[model samples]
Every structure is written in structure tokens, then in C-alpha cells.
Target: MRRSPDLHLPQATRASAGNLPAFLAACAVAVPVLLAVSAGNIADPIVRYDDYPALLAQPEGFWQKTLTEGRWLNYLWHLRGVVTPAWLNFVLFQILWGVTAAAIAAAAIPPGNRKWFAAVLALTLLPAPPVFLMAPWSSTLIPGFAVLALFAGLALVLSQRALRLLLPVFTLLAFTAYTTFPLILLAVCLISTRQRSLPDLAGLLVLFGASFAGAVLAVYALNWQVHGVFGIPLDPARSPDPAQDLAELWSHLPLLQETLSVLLGKLSFQSTPVLLFHLGLLIAATAVLLRRQPLEALYLWTALWAGMALMTLQVLKLGVTIPVRAFHFTWILYAVLIVRAAQELSRSPGLPGRLARNAVLLVALSYLVQTAVQFTRFRDWQHETRAMAAAISAQPGPVYATGSILDHPAARKAGLHRASSLELLTGLQLSQCGAVPEACAHLPPRLSSPAPEPQPQARLERFEGANVLVFPPRQ
Candidate 1:
């Protein structure tokens, strides 16, 4: 038989082919469980922040808003009527994410390597501090959409017999779900098309263009339906100046550094060694690939650049305080690179290959250990938060909360804030029998205090038919 042209792919035997589905099913279950464990206290009340209040307050209106905002399909999963207890709904969504990720791995990885690929992907999904797993706001779903879009796009470009038709459909779905995901899909398609024949590249480009245009048209139509025929909101504020945006991006360079640190699993001094070790392995693997498979190296580099470009654009558009979750595309790319590198090393023989493979395994294990520790700490924090909420709930009458659990040592250590915790408390205390209440007191922002001033202690004090809850600074 003629040798297959693709160096990375191995031929599938009959036994391996039969086992793929079972393996994928196992991965689908295992990944979400692992992620939930990492999240700590999965059964804890659904945390909330930002747009979550609106969603809880008005389910029907929220559904309508989603439809009018061009993300109508998200409502299929987000409908409050179908899924009770928002935490359970989040778990189900996470399971779907795992399934989608596994499907992509199955298409891209050869049968012999599927198990390893799945494990790496699962580890990548574990909640790192700052990159929270909860989707309190609509934009938080962007990472999940981006992952599915990239993988589906890769399957379309790499697999000859996979669901080629569905890839474009998936890409379009991701595009409508979040504005940023389409760019990721486009990047993947572009990189994948680089190795194809001229005709094949042209066809793929045409498909991508059509999908992009379709997504834009759909959004415009939705906007028109929600607003007027103008399809544009009438905001009185002046448009952001491009020059000022660029300057702001420059000023927020440290945010990018912090994002990279979190993505690399370097949240503390202890994890620093592991991060360095992984970086060294990545460098070695990149060198080997560049020497042996220049095209593949170029493809990886292009994907990394694409992710960075997307992040940079976000910082410029949204201002300097970019959320850690926004780096999901870049994080995904890093995981892919590390996993692919390890796989490539596995193909080699002799002492050097063994050492490289062992190093990769060690790094992965270290990441897991670190995550477990963080999860344990987070669990304790959740216990404390629940207790605090309970105490506040027992107090009768109107309540006003100031200061955030973000000020707590545990929360700060976990790189989380009280926003979600406070919101969850409000929802629980104010809502009746799992239903959103009509009106509730809003928590005020922490007041700015001068340095050296003693931080106020957290207390629930009664004040004439009303109560005030304050989160004291950590001792």
C-alpha cells in the first residue's frame, strides 16, 4: 500500500476504529467531572454577576433579548423554564463543551493517540484562578464557542471524511454566539488552508467569506428587529477615538502579562518551576518541528499569532481591564502546542525521546496537583461564603451590603471576587422558592479609602427595620 502523506497521522486498525466511540463517550463524562471538581463545590448556589441579575429577574425578557441581540440560539440552552437551579444548567453546558472538544480531538488525532489528546484537552479545561468557569454574563460563553469553532474548523480542514458540511454550520453558529469566536474560526481555516491545493484553498476561503457575511447579516437583521430599521443604537456618547484606544492598550500591557501567567499555570511562586519546565519543553518541541516539519511549525505559529491578535484587539476595543477569560483562545492554542509536541516526541526513540516524554507528563501532572490544591482552598472559601450568606439571610428586614468578598484572603488567593458570591446571596435571600423576586436591594461598590487606614470589619448590623452587611478586611 502507498504510504500516507501525513506524517502526524497513523493508520487506524479495525480494533482501534471500533473503540473510538466508547473512548469519546468516556471522555465526555470524565472531562466535565474533572472540571467540576476543579471548580470546587459544584452544588453550591449559582453564583451571579453583571447580566445575571437581569437574566434572573426577567427570564422571558432575557430570552427575547437574546433573540433580538443575534444570539437567539443560546436561549435554547439558557431557557430558565427548562433548566432549574442555574448551577445544574452550567454543568450540562460544560458536558456539552467536553463532548464538542472530544469530537474535535477524534477528528484531528489518530486513533492510537486519541486517549492522550483527550486527557490533555480535559486538563486544559480545568478552571485556573482568574479564568473562572461560570458564565454569569453572556460574553463568558465566548471561550466555549471559540474552542468548538477552532476544533470544528480544524476537523473540516484536516479530515477528508469527517462532517465537512457541518463545519461551516458550526462556525456560523459560533459566530452568532459571540463576535470574537468567528475570528478564531477564520484563523484556523486560514492556517489549515495554507497546506491545501489552490482550488481547495479557494473553496474554503469562499465558504468562510459566505459564513462571515451570513453571520453579519443575521446580527443586523436582529438589531433591526429590536431597534428600528436603522439597525443601529442611538447612543449619545461620542465614539471612541482610535488613538486613545491604542494608548490605553499600551497602558494595559501588564494585564496581558497576568493573563499569560495564569494560562501557563504560574499563579504562584511554587508553580513557577513547572511553568519554566513546560516552556522549555515547548521550545524544544518547536525547534524539532521546525527542523523536521516546517509547515506544521508555521501552522502552529500562525494560530498563536491569531490568538494574540484577537486578544490585542479586545484590549483596544474594550479598554485595558480585559478579563482573564478573554485569553481562552490563546490558552487553547498553548494546550494544543504542548500536547502536539509531546505526541511528536513520543514518535521518537532512544533516551532523549523518553526524557522529553517524561518531562511533558510531569508538567501535566504538576498542573493537576496545583489545580487540586486550589480547588480545595476554593471549597473552604465557598463554605465561608455560604455561612456568611446564611447569617445575613437570618436577619429580618431590608438589607444593604457593602464591601466585597473579594477583600477576603481566601477569595484574593483564588483570584476571585465577591461579585458572584454577593449576587448569589441576593438571589437566594430575595427570591421566593427558586423564583426571582421583583425588587431587591442592590449592593453598593466599596468606598475608596486612604492608605494606612484600618479596613472595616465585616458585620451584619441591624438599623431600624433594615440591616447593613459589611465584608470586613482579612486579618
Candidate 2:
């Protein structure tokens, strides 16, 4: 394949004001602070449906689960939840976010082209994802490996020789946690596409594959010794018919389109103007970048296709519902592509450049406020849920739990749902009275007639529009 014309990527576009410190510091500080505000609820959420037997599981039982579950590094972070309060263990995630942001800043800002705007541009619109911060479910919080891969990949591009040797070791650490499938692939695709030469891209791809395989083998060996399992659990058990999910691409094209549309529509962070602004920025960036620099725009297009291919493969392999987390990195990648566009436009030699630069900065600051206002609704859900849980725990026997806290109008307005009795009352020492079939039956008195018995143990309370049966606390 012939090479496209040179890109004004960081290596090519860095101008010498020698102003690295300011941009680096801004990203390092800004991303984390924004993250803290958007997701800084340090309260213990009721354990999720899938996450049950986690907080309730004693410290001793968790390690066994970690082995089969895969994602050891992730589980190691989870180790805190079982040992102490899940809330406290969650603070460790904040530290992880900090380290991730700082590390990415180090990788993206340096020797950056386009004056020092790369730092600011790296986080152009939405910075940290709110889901990772809410920490409601660890399943969706795989940002750790993704970010680490990004840093490692970018560092390799910086010619960090040590990483070439260390990438797999680190990839092992990440892979052992989340099945290095996406992270390794992302890193390789990211670095390789940034390359100016085909040979370099091929070499990097080989290195990524080899390092990742080494990590996978190492994990399999460890599991073999510990659990007598000979196989690595890399997502869905690979089937004989790789195309089983689709069976035939032509027939399933409609399904794929519908799936994509739903994913875009269900982005929790989208609230009116927020969605509009996101789309506007993307369209504007793609148009500007494609016109101004088609070859570089090809890089974004290639990366996007690679991301979608991974997501499609995952959905096909899993043979089930669409995982929202599949969209997580792709969403971030969209922001990144737009950020790169804004940065490139900022280097133009005319009034249009000035407008592009200023407009992008305004977009950045605008989203900063939007993030705090929009995504911060998570805290409200937690607060309301806590009050309801406290009410339920205070009641006596056979309190009918409709799982109503989340069903209330206030919750739906906030883009929150799914407050399972099993999940919401676990740490509260309360039982669902059979309202939730799977809810703990420690207090097993089913409401005979959808009404709590009139006694000191029962107090009927109301939340939003839902009737909440409160039981007096167990003595």
C-alpha cells in the first residue's frame, strides 16, 4: 500500500514555544477535577445484580472468583470491596483515574505539535466518562486497561524503547484483568495508524500480537496451576462457526444497523443540547479535517472502523444483547478525533484558524459545565436510593419491595433505572420479602395482600409516586 501524504500529527506539528509544562499541568489537573465532580460519590451503592456475592462474599472467597472471572488486575482493585466497605475501595478508582489522566497527559502533551494545544485538545469535549466514576458495576469500568494501553501505545510512538520490552508485561497486567483483546488491539491500531511508513506499522502490529500472546499464555499457565483450568477465558467461548451470531452478514445487516442506532440513542450522558453539541462537533470536525487533510482524516476513519469491528465481533461472539460498555472507548475515540481536528485547525494561518481555535476552546469549556450539570445526576440517584434503602431497612417483616426507588419519576428523569431489591438492599441488612425472586430471603415474610401488617414494625412511606414499606430496624 502506498503511503498517504504526511500528517500534522504531534510529531510533525509541534511548534517550539517550548511551552510543555502549562499544557501538561492543565490536562493533569483539569481532567481529574472534572472527574471528581462528575463522579465523586463515595457512598456504597447497593451491590448490583451481577455483582451480588461480591460485597457479601468474604475476603477469602474473592480470590477464587478472580481466577475464573479473568481480569485479575481489575479484581485486585475489587479486592478492596470485599475486604472493606465497597465505597472505600471505590476511592482507589479515583486514584486510578488520577494516574490515568496524568499518564495520558504525559503521553499526549509532550513535544506536542500545534504550539502546546495538544494538551487541551486531548480532552476537547467530554473528558472522563461518568460510568467509570459511578462505579456501580465493575463490569462497565474497564477504562483502566484501555487508558493504560493508550499511554503505553503513545509512549511507544515516542520511541520509549523500554516499553517495547515492557509492553507485554504491562499488557499482561492489563490482559490478565480484562482479556487483553481490546486494549492490545487498540494500542496496536492506534500506534500503527499513526505511523508514516507501512513497514513500521507492520512491525508494531507484530510486536503487539506477540507481547499479548505472551501475556495470555502466562495467565493460562497460572490458572492451570491454581485452578487446573487449561484454557484462557477470553470472552465468549470461541465457537466452531465464527459467524454463528450473524450466520450471514447480508441477512443481519438490519440487525447491525438497529444495534448501532440504539447504542447512539441510549448514551446516558445525552440530555437535549448535550447530544446536539456532541454531534455538531463530530460533524464539524469530520468535514473540516477531511477537507483540510484527507490522509490524516483517513487515520481517524481507520481507527473508528477498527473500533466498530471489535465491537461487532464482541457482540457476535457473546451472542446476546449489546453491551453498553462496548461503546465506551469508541465514544472516547470520537472525542479524540474531533480534538485532533480542532488542534489541526488551530494551526491554520488565517482568521478561520483563529475562529476554529476559539470555537473549540469555547466548546471545551461549555462541555465542562454541561458535564457537571448533566452527568452529575448520578449523585442524586445514589442519595435518593440511600434514603429509600434506609426506610426499607427500618421496617419490620414482610415489607413489600416494589423495587420502587428506581421506578419513581425522579429516577427516570435522571437517566437512572434498575434498582433491583437484590442490589439495593444487600448492604442494608434488609430482605425483599420475595418482591425480588433473587433478593436475599434473610427476612422471609411475603406480603400476604400487598400491604404491610399494621404494627410498630411497619411504617408506610412514600417516595415520589411509589409506596415504600418501611420496617423498623432489627434489634
Candidate 3:
């Protein structure tokens, strides 16, 4: 493999300013404060979405099921009545994992490119786009977690240390069942190639693989006990068929065009600079790749494909089907490739590496600044939503809002008892109780119902005639 020439370390005082360990430590400190502040603003008692609702409604049983059945293994097993507290805890841990992954990816960069790598990773984590504008926050958070797991696994595989060799296996098993297949392929590829030591790689492979396989067996056993089935069957409605999902993805081609136009179209001081910044980098990268090579060519191809896949989903009306944050893994990998290419070109005596590095830094920095600004804005808006939820909770009569079309679990998670769009509850009831909507009308108005041991103190009542009341949360 080709490598870069090392410039002598600067004086200790100068080196301190650019220290990787200190920089990462600072990042560690900053990320939690940022996450805490962000969470504080958005973590209202009101249900923002369904996952939270399920966790709050059924905590203990949920945790029990997740531990036994595996993540994504038992969700459909018990249906809505089953809560997955373990999954929530998994999510919280995954978020922390994401921070660690980002730090690792930043660290893997050459010392000189550390700042730019950090910038690129940050931008990937928090992009400003229509998806960010429209999707639920969990949408962002879930994929963000998945992406972290994916990249961390990659880093571990590449590092080839004994401890690191087993990293991908645990990460894949801990995150999701569906994602493990590709990751296994990655592990086997690295192991078989003798890219790293065989003993260490094979040992970790068996250890982690056995653990994952054992978890699967345990989940299968649980399913047999619960529903008399040895397999955890996919829900027909929710099962993923690549062809179908791809078609569903293609339907949003027009929206993709619009979003592209938005990103590349124009920028005002008030508008997000994300589009402009990325576009500039795209151009610069194109220029750098004018001469392709084994290393340079592969990096170019990977980056292109990643971008295309992301943009294709956006265009297909899927509206960012893949988490934008997750795309950072590809971004970081390609960034490494770019640095490598620059190193190769600069060593040839004619071209100035410093000038190229400075130029790349400028472009990368612009994108980084734009991404930070976008994250701050998102944080601000989410704060408003939390405030709104609290204000609504504080009111006497059931509060309504255009937000009522919210995913049911969000309400449940928020600890709100009021039903928005009785249709949702009605459907859920029908699914659970196998009762028809028409049958409800046949029942007496004063039908007796069991009362709760502890009555709910307040609820934002929702009904068909109610108007959704959405207001900015109090400052």
C-alpha cells in the first residue's frame, strides 16, 4: 500500500495545538454536552412518536422480551401489548457508540488531515435537507445509531488488532439482525485475505459468530415457547422485499429533483449553506480525480456510489431512505483515500502538497460550518416541539394540533392518554381485538368499562372534530 511522507513533528508547543488525543478528548467532552442540551430541549413528556410510547407503556416486559428475543426478533411476537425497554436502552447505548465511532474515524485520519476528517464526519452526522426538515427525529436518530455500528465495525476490521478483530461481530449482533449478513461478508473477506493475522482474526470470528448464532437460537427458542413457532417470522406488512422497496423508492423521483434543486439552487444568509458547501467539495473532488489509479480509482468509485445511492433514494420520493448520518462512513473512507491520493501526487516533486492540503481544508471547513449551523437550527426547532408538548399537557381540555396525525407510539411514549385521529386507535383496536369499527356503534353509550387503579391526571383529548392546536413552546 502507498503511504504519505511524514513531515517532522512541530515544536512541542505547536504540536500541542494540533494534538489528536487532546482534540478527541475535547470532542468527547463537547458531544455529550451537545447531546444533553439537544435532548433537554426535545425530551418532552408528550409522545413525539411510537417507539417511545411502547417503552413507556410497558417497561419491564419490554426489556425482558428484547433480551430474550433479540433486537427486531420479537417486535411482532407480542404486538403493541409488548414493550421493548431493552431496545430503548440499546438505542441510548448505540447513540454513545456513535460518538465513539466518530471519534475513532477522526482519529484514523493522518494527523495533518484530522481537522478535515472531523469536519467531514460531523457534516455526515448532521446534514440539512428536506429529510431533516420533514422526518421524525427518531428517523434521524435510529439510522444515526445504525451508521455508527456499521462504521465502527469497519474501523475494527481494518485495525486488525486482536481486540478489534471481534469488534464487528459484537457491533452487528448488538445493533440489528438484518445488518449482520453484509458485515459477516466483510469480516470473512478481511480474515481470508491474510490482510491481518490469521489466528487473531479466526479466533474472534468464531467467538463473535458463535455469540451471534447463540442469540439467534435463543430467540428462536423463545418464539417456539411464546407462539409455538421455532422461527421469528416477519410481519407480512412490514417485511422488506428489495424489489418492492426499490420500487417504492423510485416513486419519489420528482421530490428528489426538487430537493436537489434546493440544495444546489441558491443560498441566502438565512438558508442552510449545506448544499453550497457540499457542491463545492463535489467540484473540487472531481478535479482531484482527473487522474485515476488503483487506490484513487477505487475511492472515487466508492464515493460516487455512496452519493448516488443516497441521492437516488432522495429522488425516488423515499426522502432519504438511508440515514444521511450513516453516509459519513463512506465519506470518511473516501476522505482517507483523497488524502492518500494527495500524498502520492505531492511526493512527485512538482505539485505543492501544502497548497492542495490548504485548499481541501477550506472546502472541508465550509461544509463543516454549514453542518454545525444546520444542527443548531434543528436543535432549536425540536426544542419548540417539546415546549409545545409540555404546554398542551398543561392545559385542561384535551389539546389538539395538526400534530395529531402523529404516530401512535409517540403519544403513548409521551405519557398522553388522549387519542388523536380515533382512526389510528380504531385500527389498532381492530388489529388487536379483531373488532370491527361498525360494531362499536352497536354498543350502548353507557357501556361499563373497567377503571384504572391509578387514573391519568391529564390528557390532551383528541377527537375527529377537535382542531389541532400547535404553538411555539414558551421561551
Candidate 4:
């Protein structure tokens, strides 16, 4: 590969030697905010198509599904649920991901300010614009697996050949779960790394390219093991047919501005244009300031542009709008900007310094407000789901949805983006069948018909885009 003269890399520094302590402290600082971010899920409601507690509870379910599509990491992620409550399991993983993100950021930044950088990064993740924290279930939590994989890649950069050999194993376990952010975050780390042990800008590109190729191969292999097929689904959670999802992305390629808006957190329930703007401005400023260090600024610019291109595809079932959890790159980008701004401000004293500081503060404050609103929506969603469940359970033999939509503002906001079924809220053991086929629309006489057979408890209902909250999840 040709090394571009324009690519200037950061000089090597030794301040990051205390990464172990910084990593621990960053986790401590991030936990409380993470808890607050998803507090509503602690009490009630599962969002979207989350499998979590229900599917995980089964003996041969999420907890024991090792080597599954090479996504065994996600199942391992939830093993805590076996001992802790569902809410705690959900919150813990969110915190873990935040901490992992922070550690990666801290390591990639200047040594002197790494701790503060990590802490700020941690604070930004949950309360950030793309408030994926408000969601519950296995699908949202899968992002953590990607973060872990990114962290592993960073470790590989420093590890000797022996440990670097384990990179493939780590990729096999993590890449099958999520891919949108791993490539982006790895690039960020490589650019930000002080020369200490890292190579030049071209080496950074080589590193990311190698990491990506390894992850893809791992997923390619794992898909065969778990899905009993030979295919590469960049993210298996989207759909069994990832090719269709890719088609959705290709179709939306022309709507660049519109698609970018969605990627930056402009969903029905979470509208955060301002937070994203501040993040952009702050990072852009940081990049300009680092132009002297050729590589960092270029990667900053590259990360933003690359992010716009590598969009998270909204599976065919959900249309073309990607889910908020898929915005992991955005979360990392904001965190990196905050830290980079702080590092620059400390070195200078002027109006630009104040502006950078204010930009970061505004970004944080904006995210805080968005996070609160998201949680309030979550609380309202749970309350309405419970009330509706009660109303449905009190009915006669079988309750057909009067209308497919739930009658609540929060639920309408949720509409087709949330959980498999509100039946979990009903808390009744009554036999429930999903989407009664046209042929089975009318049932036999209750007196002559045998007792309603108990249905499988798993959330395996096919999603036909009609009221996602009421329907059982896809198998």
C-alpha cells in the first residue's frame, strides 16, 4: 500500500502507561449514569424484538448457546441474568459496554488526560443522542459484543505474536453479533494512538483492514456452524436473509442526507439533531487543531465520512430505518470529541478553548435531556402496556386486537419499533397463538373442541409489520 504524505500520525507518548487504573476508574464513574439512562426498564417493559429474559430463561436458550453463529459472546453477556434480575442484567451490560468504550478511548488518547477522557466518554454513552440505553432485550445489548471485539483488536496491537494469534478466536466470537461500529471504532483507536508502539498512518489503515477481514472470515465460518448455512450476515439479528437488508441499504444510498439524519438519532421517539451537531462541530474543531499531527485529523475526518457510508441497515421487517442501538459509532464519535476537546483546551487558553468547552457541555446537557425524555417514554410505555394487558386478560375466551395499534402516546411512538408481544405484560398462562392464519380464523365450538393446547413460550412469531408490540417475535 502506498503511504500518503498527507497522513500525519501522532507522536509517541508514554502517559498511557497507567491504562489499568484509568480503565477501572472510568468504569466507576460511568456506572451511575448508565443506571440512570435505562432506569425505566428496571421496573417494566421490554422494547422492540428483545429476546433477553424470556428466551434466555429456557434451558437450551441464550444462556447455553455457545458457538452460536460465533455470537456466543452475546449469550455469555447475558449469563449474569441467570443470577441477577432481568433489569439488572440489562443495566449491567449497558454499563459494561460504556466502560469498554471508555477504556478504548482512554487508551487511544494522550496519556496525561486519558482518565478524564475515559470518564467523559463513559458519561456520554448512555445519555448520548442515540439513546439506545432506553431499549431493552437481547438485540440492543448485542452492541456490547462489538465493543468488546474492538477492545480485543486494540489489545492485539500491543500484544506479542502469541496473543495476537488469539485475535481470530475473539473475532469469531464477536463479529457475528455486530459489525457497524467495530470497524469505525478500531480506526479511531489506531489514529489516536500515540506512536509509542503503533506504526504510521498507512499502518493504521492496514491494521483496520486486517481487523475487518479477520472479523468477516470469522462470521463467515460461524454462520455455517450456528445457522447451518454458508453465508455472511454482517449482523444476523437484522434478518436471516442479510442480502435483502443490504438491498435496503443500497436502495437508500441515494437518500444520503435523510439516511444520515436517521443514523444521527432522528427517530420518531428520539429526536436529537442539536446534540449530533455539537458533536460534529466539536470533533471537526478537534480535527483542525490536530492537523499538525497529520494522521489524527485525517482519521477524524475519515471516521465521520466513513460512518455516513457504513450505515446500519434496517432489516426488511422494520423497513429502512435502522435502530438506535446500531449507532454505536456515533456514541464513540461523541465520546472521542469530548475527550479531544478537553485535551486541546488544557493546552491552550483563548476564546476557541471556551467554545470547545461550551460545545462539549452543551452536547452533554442535550444528551442528558434526551435521555430523560426517552426514559419517561419508557415508563409511560410500561404503564400503558400493563393497563392494556389487564384489559385483554379480563376479556372472554380469546381477545382479538380491536385495532393493531396500542392506545397510548408512548406506545404509538413505539408503534412498530418495540417488542414482540405485549402478552408478557398480560402475565397469563393462557394459550396464545400468533397471527391467526386466515384458515384458522374461526375456531371450533369450545364445548366440542379440546382444551386449548399450550403454545411454545418462545417469542417466535413472524413479524408482518402489523403492530410489532402486539405480535410475537420472529423465530
Each model's C-alpha lDDT?
0.51, 0.50, 0.40, 0.51
Error of 4 at 256 (Å): 5.0
The TM-score measured for candidate 1 stands at 0.70
Residue-level lDDT tens digits of model 2 in 321-366: 4545445555555655566666666565787667666766776666
Q: How do the residues 141-162 of candidate 4 rate in per-residue lDDT, one tens digit apiece?
A: 5445455735533552453332
The list of candidate 2 runs beyond 4 A from truth reads 1-23, 39-69, 78-92, 109-116, 125-134, 138-158, 180-195, 212-255, 266-300, 379-381, 388-428, 435-475
* Candidate 4 least-lDDT 10 residues: 456-465
TM-score of each: 0.70, 0.68, 0.47, 0.69
| Backbone clash count for every predicted candidate, in the order shown | 2, 11, 18, 5
Question: lDDT tens digits, residues 278-365, model 1?
Answer: 5676688788767755656666666667557666664455444344545555544555566656666667567766776576556546
Candidate 2: worst-modelled 10 consecutive residues by lDDT:
447-456
Model 3, 140-198: lDDT tens digits are 13433444445443442343344354544554444343223223233222322223344
Candidate 1 residues lying further than 4 Å off, grouped into runs, are: 1-36, 51-57, 60-70, 75-80, 111-164, 183-206, 229-276, 314-321, 392-395, 402-424, 428-457, 473-475
